[model samples]
Target: MIKFFRKIRQNLLSEGKTAKYFKYAMGEIILVVIGILIALQINNWNEEKKYQKQLHIKVHSILGDIREDALQIKALLKDLEKQHSAADHIIPIMESEQKAIVDSLKFILDFNSFTTTPILSQQNNTWDYLSANGILSELEDQELVNLLMNYYNYFDELTINFNNSANPVRLELRELKYELFTNTEHRKFFPTKKPSVPSKAVYESIFNDIRILPLCRYIGSTAAYFEGRFKDVDQKAEKIIYYLETNYQPI
Candidate 1:
């Protein structure tokens, strides 16, 4: 094509047709400009396609991370509720006449420790990477970003606080309960399938103990807070999942 154009220009110039040569040169210039414009347009399209592909990969990774977190948190949430149930049993028995029952004390011995807590698994790497590198915005889902922030920042911190607070308090409760009961009674309560009756005075001592009640209150409130936060996280995860399943796709 270049040679063809060159020959035509040479013939026109050699014939001294300067006007036609100028017109042909101008036509050639226009064609070159059009070609450049087309090249630039194609480059821009390729860049956009690459951007979309990257966003799709990041979004898919994030969805997978959240789904795992959701599964783990579901079990953790149930565990928190179970702890609450344990607290529920202990508190009522202590507050009521049933405190003297051997079964009640056995239940207390089984469930009174705050050592058991929900173990939450977080899928933070995906979120942290996308966020720190500033790729999270590539997906253009501001709502999803905010929800993730809430989970990682606020909700994760809530879980940490709940666990940290329980640790020292659990030790204190264990010490106090041992102090309130005889070694024989405490040991007997544990291995006994059917808890045998301890003296009413033993029950009264535990019930009237100032230390025990505070520990109970702490356990109850903490369990309640944990349960609520678990539910809140569940809802947040579900919403993101819904958005992903409903609206999610390769960009």
Candidate 2:
């Protein structure tokens, strides 16, 4: 194609049609400019297609992370329910003057239950990557982006609260456990170790401790509070997952 254009230019130059040659040369330059523009446009289109594909993969990965978070939240909620149940059962018996003679094993088990703290493992690696790289703004769905920001921010606040508020309470509970229960009593709940149950007197000592009632109440209340928060976040995660799945296509 270049050789053909050169031959045409040479003919125009040799024919002594100077004005015509200038016009032809100008036309050839314009055509070359247009061709370059077209090539650039094509390259831009290819780059855009590649970007869309990468965005699709990232969004899908985010969906997977949210799904995993939802599952973890569900498990945490279940554990919280058990903790709440244990507190419910233990509190009334401790409060009553005529304490019901609950089974020693059952009392020990409930003691262990309310004291166990459920830690939520949030799946935020993809989100962290996007945020760190400034790719979150590249997401075209503004609503989804806002939702993600709010969701992660909420988690961050929750983590901070847990560290500042809940950790001390948990640590106190651990101290109380050591103070109230003997080593044999502590080992009773271990599944792998079939240690002999502590005497009834040991169980009664824990049950009679007035301090435990308030701690149980605190655990119960916090369990309920965190359960509500976990459910809320899980619902938001599910909403985000549904939106991504429904609106996005594989590129």
**Top-lDDT candidate index:** 2
Clashing pairs in 2: none
Question: lDDT for each of the candidates?
Answer: 0.75, 0.78
- Which residue pairs in candidate 1 have backbone atoms (N, alpha carbon, C) closer than 3 angstroms, thus clashing? none
| Tens-digit lDDT track of model 1 for 105-204 | 5465545445454555678787888788987667677887787787778667876886688556766776776787787876655446766656555667
RMSDs, each prediction?
4.1, 2.3
For all predicted structures, in order, the TM-scores are 0.77, 0.89
Tens digits of lDDT, candidate 2, 133-167: 99988888899899889888987787667657655
TM for candidate 1 is 0.77
The residue-level lDDT of candidate 2 at 180 comes to: 76
